[model samples]
Each structure stands twice: as C-alpha cells, then as structure tokens.
Target: MIRMENVVKRYNELIALDHFSFAAKEGEIIGLLGPNGCGKTTAINCMLSLLTFDKGEIEIFGQQVHPNNNAVKSRIGIVPQELAIFDKLNVYENIDFYCGLYVTDRKKRKALVEEAIEFVDLGKYRKFVPKKLSGGLKRRLNIACGIAHKPALLFMDEPTVAVDAQSRNFILEGIRKMKAQGTTIIYTTHYLEEAEQLCDRMVIMDSGRNIASGTVHELQNTISTQERIEVGFITEDQTIEAQLEELPHVVKVTKRNGNYLIHFEKQENNLPDLIKFMESRGMSYTELSSERSTLSDIFLELTGKELRD
Candidate 1:
C-alpha cells in the first residue's frame, strides 16, 4: 500500500534520511523503530508530504504522494504522538471536526463520529472538554478524532505513550479491531514489547538508513546470541563461570542479578549439555531458566547500546 525507495533528506549540513527504503502491504501493522535522531519522524513526514525530500520516490495507494493530493489524503489518517485536540472543544465536537475534513455529508459524518466515540470507549466523555478529561481519556479522544473517518491507511505515532495500563490495552485491542477490518496501520513506539506484540513486521532504522526489516523471528535469527540460560546455583565455586563456558556452543557468560547468564550460539543441545555437565560435577542449582533472544536483544545488537539524544 506504501513504498519509499532510497529517500534522501538533508537539512543544511546534516542528513536526516540517507538512502532509506521501506515498504508496507495492506492490512499489516508495520513497526518503525529507531533511536532518537534516527529519522523515523523525518521519513514519516516525507511520506505524508509534510516535508519534501532531496531524492527518491514515495507512493501511497499506487499514486505519488503530494501535499495537495486530496484523493490520497482523504484515504489516510494521522494520530500524532502529541495530543492534537483543541482544549475548548468537547469530545464529540473534536471528533466531528476531524471527520468532517474527509466526510462532507453531515448525516454520514455524524454516524461516523458516533461510531468513533463508541470505538474508543469515549461515549461517557462525549460532552467533556479536553481540560475536564484525564490523561488517558484525552488520549482516547485523540484517537477517536483521527480515526473517525475510517481511513484505509493510518499512521499512529506512540498512541499509547504515558497512558495507564488499562487505556493502553484498550487502544491496542482497538488497533487489532482496525486491522481485522482491513485497515493498514503504521505503528511507532518506544515500547519494544508493545511493538513485538502488535506489529506483524518491523523496520529498524539507524543513522537515517534502513538497517533491518523483517518479522520478529527473522530478526532474531540474524543476531549471534540465539539463546540465554540464567542459572543460580546454591553451591558457589569461584570457577563456576569458567567451568560452564567449557560446554558446547557457549558464547560468553555474564553475571546478572546474582545469577550467571550464559549466552549460547544456535544449538539444539545447549540446555541438555549444560545439565549433563552439572550432573557430572555434582553441582546443584537453586534456579534455572532458558529463553530465546528477545526483540530488545536484537535491537541492542543492531544498534549500539550507547545513550542517544
């Protein structure tokens, strides 16, 4: 439904998007992930024609993206990271105003606005102005406004940021419902777990480039550490870490919270080999757990673990 190729955007002496390329199919949730200053927002702005790029092409719904392309703009919706509601407008009026941008017919727009209120569970606050609602409620109203017209493609940037757990879950479930109804959503968030749970595929960006793009399992397979086993032994020996390192396929071992976290390369017998080696030495353990590499691990491995501004 969307395609961008070798996009280049520069600002004075700095480059915001350097040969970045990405694509999204219909009815899929694509996660756009990156550290700060990585050009995620820049790329989105270029696609939305909010910002023009120096090079490359961006197409949405099989047509070139432009600011004045009302046909394309009418079929798209944007829920930005910040709340876009007016403080003076009530919930129903806020949603109605945004929906009216695309839906001109008063009767159809009114029904769509009511549906949006119920979809976001904002019926109770339909008459409440932005100042009277809580943070989570305000977020719900923001979502309702953007989605009231039922656009085919939606760009949701950190829709759940700083909201309570209940509201977050509600928003996520509502997103799933949108997907079920054939809406393609481009999702962005700082919460890795949320992206892992919600996105069908992800595109990781760094230094204004598309570093990696794939499903979660595909990304996991690209990293070196395939599995991690955390073990806490009741009997402590000074050489226990070194001894465990001798096991087959062992990459490295690090201490984490009074436990030894053993990193291992891909192997089917990692756990069983460790268990047999411990049995031979008569070593007993207090706690033992095994898990595959997670999205956080993949992210850190791809992007250096240094702080980003």
Candidate 2:
C-alpha cells in the first residue's frame, strides 16, 4: 500500500536519510525500528510528505505523495509520538474534530466518532478533557482521535509509549482489530517486544538506511547468535568458560547473574552438545534454560550496543 525508494533527505550539512527504502503491503503492521538519530522519523516524515527529500519517490495507495494531495492525505492517519489533542476539547469533541477532517457528513462523522470512542473504551469519559484523564487514558484518546476517521493507512508513532500495561494492551488489541478490518498500519516504537508481538514484518533502519527488512524469523537467521543457553553450574570452576568455548557452534559465553550464558551460532544441537560436554567433565548444573534469540538481540547485533541519544 506504500512504497518509498532510495529516498535521500538532507538538512544543511547533515543527511537524515541515505538511500533509504521501505515498503508496506495492505493490512500489515510494519514495524519501523531504529535507535535515536537513526533517521526513522525522517523516513516517516518523508513518506508523509511532511519533509521533502533530495532524491527518490514515495507513493501511497498507488499515487505519488505530496503535501497537498488531499486524496492521499485523507486516506492516511497519523498518531504522532506526542499527544495531538487539544487540552480544551473533551474526548468526544476531540474525536469528532479529527474525524471531520476527512468525513464531511455530520451524520457519518458522528457515527465514526462514537465508534472511535467505543473502540478505545472511552465511553465513560467522553466528556472528560485531556488534562483530566490519566496518562493511559490520554493515550487512548490520542489513538481515538487519529483513528476516528478510519483511514486506510495509519502511521502510528510510538502509540504505546509511556502508557500503563493495561492501556498498552487495550491499544494493541484495538490495533489488531483494525488490522482485522483491513487497515494498513505503519508502527514505530522503541519497544522491541511490542514490535515483535504486533508487527507482521519489520523494517530495521540505521543511519537513515534500511539495514534489514523481514519477518522476525527471517531477521533472526541473518544474525550470528541464533540461540542462547543459560547454564548454572552447581560446582563453580574458573576454567568452565574456556571449556564451554571448545564446544561446537559456540559463539561466546558471558556471565549473567552467576550463570554462564552461552551464545551459539545457528545450530540445533547446541543444548545437547553442552549437556554431553558437561556430563563428560563431571560437571553438574544447578539451573539450565534455553531460549531463541529475541528481536532485541537481532536489533543490538545489527545496531551495536552503544548508547544513542
């Protein structure tokens, strides 16, 4: 439903997007992930025509994106990272105002506004203003306003950020319902687990370029450490780390809360190999656990562990 190719955006001496390319199909939640200053926001702004690029093309719903393209803009909804509701407006009025931007008919807009309020479960607080609501409630109201018009494509930038767990779940479930009803959502968040859970596929960006794009499983295959085993030995030995490194497919081993967290390359026999090696050495483990690499692992491996401002 959306396509951006080789987009390059420059601001004076700084290049925000460097040959960045991204695509999203209809009815899919595409997670746009990156650390701070990675150009994720720039890419989104370029696609939304909020920012102009030096090169490349952006198309939504098979038409070129332009700031004044009301047809395309009307079909798009933006839930920014920051709350976009007026503090003076009550919940119902806030929703109605945003929905009225696209749906001019008062009857249809009113119905859509009510649906949005119900969708976010803010019926009881329909008359409450933004400042009167809690953080989570305000977030729900934010989501309701953006979605009141029911655009075909939605750009949700950190919709679940800083909200309580309950509200986050409610928003996520509502997003699922939207997807079920055929809304193409472009989701951006600092929360990797949320992205892993909600996104159908992900596009990983760094330094303004599309470094990786695929399903979680596909992205996992591209990284070196596919599996991690946390083994705690009953008998501690200083040489255990060196011995564990000798095992096949062993990438590296690090200490984690007194347990030896072993990183292994892509292999099925990692756990079995560790058990056999420990048995031969007469070593006993007090605790043992195995887990596949997570989205955070893939992200860190691709983006590095350095702090980003």
Candidate 3:
C-alpha cells in the first residue's frame, strides 16, 4: 500500500535519508526501528509528502505522493509522536473536527466521530476539555482525532508514549483490531516488547539506512547471541558458577539473585545439553528458565548501548 524507492533527503549538508527503500503491504504492521538522527521520521515524512525528498520516488496506493494529493491523503490517518489537539475544544469537538476533514455530510461525520470516541474508549469524557483529562485520556483523545475518518492506512509514531499500562494495552488492542480490518500500518516505537507482540514484520534502521528487516525470529537469528539460561539451584554451590563458565559456548557468566546467569554466543541453543551436564555433575536446580533473544536484545546488539542524542 506504501512504497519508497531509493529515497534520499538532506538538510543542507547533513543527510537524513540516503537511498532508503521500504514498503508496507496491506494488513501488515511493520515496525520502523531506529535511534535518534537515524532518519526514521525523515523517511516517513518523505513518504507522506510532508517533507520534500532530494532523490527517488514515493508512492502510496500506486499514485505518486505530492503535497496536494487530497484524495490520497484523506484515506490516511496519522497519530504523531507529539499530541495534536486543541485545548479549548472538548473531546467530542476535537474528534469531530478531524473527522470533518474527510466526511462532509454532518450526519455521516457525527456517526464517525462517535465511533472514533468509542474506538479509543473515550465516551465518558466526550464533553470534557483537554485540560481536565489525565495523560492517558489525552493520548486517547489524540488517537480519536486522527482515526475518526476510518482511513485505510495509519501512521502511528510512538502513540503509547507516557500512557498508563492500561491505556497502552487499550491502544495496542485497537491497532490489532485495525489490522484485522485490513488497514495497512507503519508503526514506530521505542518499546521493543510492544513491537515484538504486535508487528508482523519489522525493520531495524540506523544511520539513515535500512540496516535490517524481517520477521521477529528472522531478525533474532541475525545476531550470534541466542538463548540466555539462568539456573537457580536448590543448593548454593560456589563451584557451580565456576563450572558453568567452563562449559562449551559459554561467553559470559554472572551471578545474580542467588542464581547463575549464563550467556552463550555462536551456539545453537544447548540448554538441554547443559541440563544433562549439570545432572551428571550433581548440580541440581530448583528453577530453570531460558529466555530467547528479544527485539531489544537485537536492537542493542546492532545499534550499540549508547544513549541517542
């Protein structure tokens, strides 16, 4: 439903996007992962024609995207990283105003506005203004405004930021419902767990380029690091930690919370073999848990563990 071919954007001398190419298929929630100055937002803005690109082509629904494509744009919904709402307007009014952009008839527009409010579970505060709502409620209001028109394509940039856990779940669930209804989505998020839980496929971006793109498992396998096994034995043996460090494929071993946490590298998960070895060595564990590499793990591994400016 959306495509960018060899797109490039520059701010005077600094390049934001350089020969970047990406696509979002219908009914797919593709996570756009990256750090600051990585050109994620620049890439999205170019696709939407919100910012001009220096090179390459952008198309949505098979039509070239330009600044004044009203017919094409009306079919898109955008919930930006920042809140976009009128403080003076009540919750219902904010939704109505955005919905009015697409639906001209007051009768149809009113129904869509009501549905948007219900979609985000904001019916209780329909008449209340922005100042009276809590952080979560404001986030919900921001969502209702963008999606009231029932667009075919949605762009959600950090939509769950700063909301309560309950509200975050509600918003995430709503995204699933939209995907079920066959709307294409381009989701950008800092929360890796949410991306792991929701995205059908993902793209890990950095340095203004497409560094990685694939399914969760596909991306995880790209890293040499695999399963992390933490073994907690009923009997505390100081020798156990030293013995585990001697095991094959063991790269790092650390003790925490009265347990041995072992990290393995370049090994097809040998947790079962480790268990057998521990049994033969008389090291019995009361609790054993293995955690597979998550998007966060891959992210830090690929992007480095430094704070983004």
Candidate 4:
C-alpha cells in the first residue's frame, strides 16, 4: 500500500535517510524497528509527505505521495508518539472534530465517531474532557481521533508506550482486529515483544538506513544466533559443560546458575539434536528451554545501537 524508492532526506549536514526504501502490503503490519535518532520518524514523515525529502520517490497505492494529495491523505491515519488532543474538548467532541475532517456529512461523521469510541472501548468517557480522563484513556482518545475516519492505512508510533499493561493489551488487541479487517499498519516502537506479537513483518533501521526487513523468521536468520537453549542441570559440572560444547550442533556453551546455556549457528531444529546428544552423555537436566533470537537481539546486533535517548 506504501512504497519508497531510493528515498533520501537531509538536515543540514546530517543525512536522515540514505537511499532508504521500504514497502507495506495490504492486511499486514510493518514495524519500523530502530534505536533513537535512527531516522525512523524522518522516514515516516517523508513517506506521509509531511516532510519533503532531499531526493527519491514515494508512492501510495501507485500514486505519488504529496502533501496536498487529498486521495492519499484521506486514506492514511497517523497517531504520533506524543499525545495530541484538545484538553478542553470532551471525548466525543474530540473524535467528532477529527472525524469531521474526512467525513463532512454530519450523520456520517457521527456514526464514525461512535464506531471509533466503541473500537477504543471509550464509551463511558465519551462525555468527559481529555484532562478528566486517565492517561491510558487519553492515549486511546488520541488514537480514536486519528483513526475515527477509518483510514485504510494507519501509522501507529508507540501507541502503547507508558500505558498500563491492561491498556497496552487493549491497544495491541485492537491493532490485531484492525489488521484482520485488512487495514495496513506501519507500527513503530522500541518494545520488541509488542512488535513480535503484533507485526507480520518488520525492518530494523539505523542511521537513516534499513539494515534488515522480513518476516520474524527471515529476519532472525540474517543474524548469527540460530537457536538458543538454556539447560539447568541438577548438578554442576565443568566436564559436562565441556562435553555439551563438543556435542553436534553446539557452537558455544556458557555456565550460568548451575546450568549450561548453548548457542548454535543457523540450522533446522537444532535443539532436539542437542537434547539427544545430552541424553547420550547420560546428563540430567532439571530444566531445558529453547528460544529463537528475539527482534530486540537482532535489532541490537544488526544496528549496534541502543533505543534509549
């Protein structure tokens, strides 16, 4: 639904995006994963035509993106990282005002506002002002304002940040529903677990460049960490650790909490092989669990950067 070709942007001497290119398909969520100052925001701004790029092309649904394009802008909704709401306006009025921008008909806008309120589960707070609502409710209100018009493409930047777990879960679940309804989403966040759960595909960007982009599995394969397994033994033994290291498919073993955690290069289901090898050695383990490299791990390894400012 969105595409960028050799897109470049600059601020003074610093290059925000150097030939940065990415695309999002229909009914899928694309996560722009990156650390702070990685130009994630810059890329989004350029794509939405909110900021003009120094060079390159951007298209939405085959049409060139433009700040003044009514068709493209009408189909896109952006919920920024920071909350933008009128403190004095009541919840219903806030949504009605934004929805009115796209849906000029009073009857149509009223229905859209109601649907948005229901989608965010803010029915009770419809009459309350932004300042009267809780922080979580205010975040939801911000989202409702952005998406009340039912845009085909939604840009959710850290929609769940700083909210309570319950509120976060609600937001995540709501995103899933939108995805199921075939709404394309460009989700950006530092929360790896949330991205892992909500995004169908993602890209890790740094210094205004896209380092990796693919499904979760495909992205993990790009890194050296193939399969990770941590086994806690009933008894600690350096000899056992050494033997475990020599086993087939075992690349490295480290001791921690009287246990041996093993890492291996990329392969197919290497954990079972490690377990079979351990059984052959007559070693008993109290606990054994396997995990793949997470988005955070891959993000850090690929970008060599942190998310914090």
Candidate 5:
C-alpha cells in the first residue's frame, strides 16, 4: 500500500534520511523501529507530503503522494505520539469534529463518531472532557479522533508511551482489532517488546538508514548470535569468566548484576559446553537458563550500545 525508493531528506549539514526506502503491504502492521533522531519521523513526514525530499519517490496506493491530493490524504489517518485532541471538547464532540474534516454529511459524521467511541471502548465517557480522562483514556480519545473517519492507512507513533499496563494492553488489543478488520498500520515505537508482539514484519533503522528488515524470525537468523545462556554464580571470579569466553560457539560474554550472560553464534551443544566448562572449573551456579535471541538483542547489536540523544 506504500513504497519509497531512495528517499533522501537533509537539514543543512546533517542528513536526516539518507537514501532511506521502506514499504508496507496492505492489511499488515509494519513496525518502523529505531531510536530517536534516526529519521523515522522525517521519513513519515516525507511520505505524507508534509515535508519535501531531496530525491526519490513516495507512492501510496500506487499513486504519487502530494499535499494537495485530498483524494489520497483523506484516506490516511495519523495518531501522533503527543496527544492532539482538544482539552475543552467532550469525547464525542472531539471525535465528531475530526470526523467532520473528512465526512461532511452531518448524519454520517454522527454515526462515525459514535462508532469510533465504541471502537476505542470510550462510549461510557462520551460526554467527559479530555482533561477529566486518565492518560490512557486520553490516548484512546486521540486514536478515536484520528480514526473516526476510518482511513484505510493509519500511522500510529508510540501510542503506548507513558501509560499504565492496563491502558497499554487495552490500546494494543484495540490496535489488533483494527488490523483484524483490514486496516494497514505503520507503527513506530522504541518499545521492542511492543513491536515484537504487534508487528508482522519490521524495519530496523539507524543513522538514517535501514540496517535490517524482515520478520522477527528471519531477522534473528541473519544475526550471528542465535542463542543466549544466562547463568549466575554464588560469587564472581575472573578466572571462571575467562573460561566461559573460551567455551564452544561462545561469541561474547558479559557479566551484569552477578549474572554471566553468554552469547553464542549459530552452533549446537552450546548449553552443554558451558556446563562442562563450569564443571571443569568446579564452579556452581545459582541460576542457569537458556533462551533464543530476542528483538532487543538484534536491535542493540545493529544500532550499537551508545545511547541516542
């Protein structure tokens, strides 16, 4: 439903988007994962035709996107990271007002507003103002306002940030419902776990370029580390740590909080090898667990450990 080829956007000496290209299929959620200042927002703005790019093409629904293309713009919705609803407007009123932007007919707009309220499970609070609602409820209202028109393509930017777990789950479940009903979403978030849970495919970005793109399993296969073993000892010892580094298939060993985390490249017998090493040294562990690689590991491995501003 969307495509970008060699998209480039620059701000003076710094290039926010460097030959960045991305695409999303219909009825699937594509998680645009990246840290701050990695060009995710810039790419979205350019795709929406809200910002001009230096080169490349962006097409939505197989047609070039333009700011004046109301025919195309009207079919897209955006739920920004920051709340965008009016504080003074009641839930129903806010949704009605935004829906009015796309749906001019008063009767149709009224129906859409009510449906949106139910869709986000905010029907009981229809008359409540934004200021009176909790953070999560406010987030839901923001989503309701953006999606009241029921656009086919939706852009959700960190919709779960800073909310309680209950509210987060509610919003995530609501999003899944939207997808099941055939809405294609482009979701952006720094929360790797959320991306893992929600996205069917992912595009990892760093330094304004795509480092990797694939399904969770496919991306995991591309990285060197395939397995991780976490073991903790009763006491820390440098000699034992060195022995672990020499274990079969062990690529990296890190110690944190009195636990030894061993990273291994794709190979067999990784766990047994670690056990043998510990036995040879006559060392005992308080905890031992084996697990496969995670999206967070892949993200840090590709983007580096340095903190982003």
Candidate 6:
C-alpha cells in the first residue's frame, strides 16, 4: 500500500532521513521502532507529504505522495501519539467533526461515527467530553476520531501510551480487528512487547535509517543471542556472574536486583549446561526460567540502546 525508495530528509546540518526506505503490504500491520531522535516521525511526515524531502520518492497506492493529493490523503487515517481531540466536544461530537472532514453526508457520517464508537467500545461514553474520560478512554476517543472515516491505511503513533493495562489491551485488540477488516496500518511505539504482539512485520529504524525489517522470528534470528535464561537465587552471588559468563555458549551474564539474566549464543543445551554447572557447584536457585530471545533483546543488541532511548 505504501513504498519509499532512498528517501532523504535533512534539517540544516543533521540528516533526519538518510536514504531511508520502507514498504507496507496491503492489510498488514507494520511496527516502526527506533530509539529517541531516530527520525521515525520525520519519515512518517515525509510519507504524508507534510514535510518535503531532499531526495528519493514516496508512493501510496502506487501514486506519488504530495501535499495536495487529497485523493491519496483521504484514504489514510492518522492517530497521533498525543491526544488530538477537543476537550469541550463530547465523544460523539469529536468523532463527528473528524469524520466529517472526509465524509460530507451527515447521515452516512452518523453511522460511521456510531460504528467507530462501538469499534473502540466507547458507546457508553458517547456524551462524555474528553476531559471527563480516563486516559485510556480518551485514547479510544482519539482512535475513533481518526478511524471513524474508515480509511484503508492507518498510522497509529504510540496509541496505547500511558493507558491502563485493560485499556492498552482494548486498543491493541481494536487494532487487530482493524487489520482483520483489511486495513493496512503503520504503527509506531516505544513498547517492543506491543510491537511483537500486534505487528505482522516490523522495521527497526536507527540513525535515520532502516537498519532491519522482518517478522519477529526473522529479526530474532538476526541476532546471536538465540536464548535467554533468567534465574533468581536465594542469595545474590557476586562471584557467580563471571563464572556464568564463562559457561559454554553463554554470550553474557547480567545481574539486576536479585536475578541473573544469562544471554546465550545460538546453540542448544544452554539451559541443561547451566543447570548441570549449578548442580555441580551445589548451588540451588529459588527460580530458574528459560525463554527464547525477545524483540527487545534483538533491538538492544542491534541498536545498542533502549527502545525508548
């Protein structure tokens, strides 16, 4: 549904996008992730033609993107990171106003607005104003406002940020429903778990460039750490850290609080080896859990920074 080729955007001396390129297939949810100041927003703005780039091309629906391309713009919905609803307008009114921008017919728009409310599960709060809603409810209102028009393409930036767990789950579930309805979504969030849970494919951006792009499993395989074992002992042993790091296939060992996180390179028997070593030393741990690599681990390994940073 969307494609960019060797796109470049600069701000004075700094490069916001350096030959950056990306693509999204129809009806797929794509997670765009990066550290702070990596130009994820800049790339989105350029794709929307809200910002002009110095080089490269951007196309949506096989047509070039431009500021005046209302035909193309009309098919895209954007739910910004910050709440973009009116505080005075009630939930229904806010949705009505935003949806009205695309749908002029009052009767048709009314149905759409109602559907959007139900889609986000905000029917009970229809008459409530933005200020009267909880953070999560307000987020739902924001999503309803953006998607009430039922565009084929959606851009959701941190839509679940700061919301309660239930609300976040509601928002994520709603996104899945949108995808099931065949909407192609471009999602950006600081939360790796959300991306892993919600996105079909993901693009990791860093230094204003697309460093990696693939499914969660494919991206995890790109990194050396194939497995991670987290163990908590009855007693925190300072000397054990170095010993664990020296174990076979153990790439690194880190201690946080009272738990030990052991990262292992691509190899089998990582857990059995660790358990054997522990039993040999007569060390009994209170907790021993093993899991494969996560998106966050791959992210940190590739970017050398936290998802939020």
Please say which candidate is ahead in TM-score: 5 or 6. 5
The superposed Cα distance between candidate 6 and the true structure at residue 4, in angstroms, equals 1.2
User: Per-residue lDDT of 73-94 in model 2, one digit per residue for the tens?
Assistant: 8989999887999989999999
TM-score per candidate, in order?
0.95, 0.95, 0.88, 0.92, 0.91, 0.88
lDDT of 5 by residue, 1-309 (tens): 999989889999899999998999999999998887788888888989989999999999999998899899889998987899998899999999889888999998888898999988998899999989999899999999889999999999889888889989998998999899899999988888899999999999888898899999999988889998899988877787788887778888887677888989975788787788788888988999888888887887777754231
lDDT for each residue of candidate 3 in 235-295, tens digit (9 for 90 to 100): 8776887899888988778777878878887546478879988999988788888878778
Best-fitting candidate, scored by lDDT? 1
CA lDDT scores, all candidates in order: 0.91, 0.90, 0.86, 0.86, 0.88, 0.90
Model 6 lDDT, residue 276, Cα:
94
Candidate 5 Cα outliers beyond 4 Å, as residue runs: 234-238, 267-269, 276-283, 306-309
lDDT (tens digit, per residue) of candidate 1 on 53-147: 99999999989988998889999999988899998899999999999999999999999999999999988889999999989999999999889
Off by over 4 Å in 4: 234-236, 266-272, 279-284, 305-309
Ranking by TM-score: 1, 2, 4, 5, 3, 6
Ranking by lDDT: 1, 2, 6, 5, 3, 4
Determine which window of 10 residues in candidate 2 has minimal summed lDDT: 300-309
Please identify which of the two predictions, 1 or 6, would achieve the higher TM-score against the true structure: 1
lDDT assessment of candidate 6:
0.90
lDDT of 4 by residue, 1-309 (tens): 888988999998999998999999988999988776778888888888889888989888889987788878889898988898888899999998888877899988888999999999999989999888888999999999989999999999888888988888899989999988889999998777877888999988888898989998988888887777899888767688778778676768876666677888766768778778879888888898887777876877787765541
**Model 1, C-alpha of 77: deviation from truth (Å):** 0.9
Q: On residues 191-276, what C-alpha lDDT tens digit does candidate 6 reach at each position?
A: 88889889999999988999999999899889989988998887766788887887888888877667998989875888889899
Residue 51 lDDT, candidate 6, scale 0-100: 95
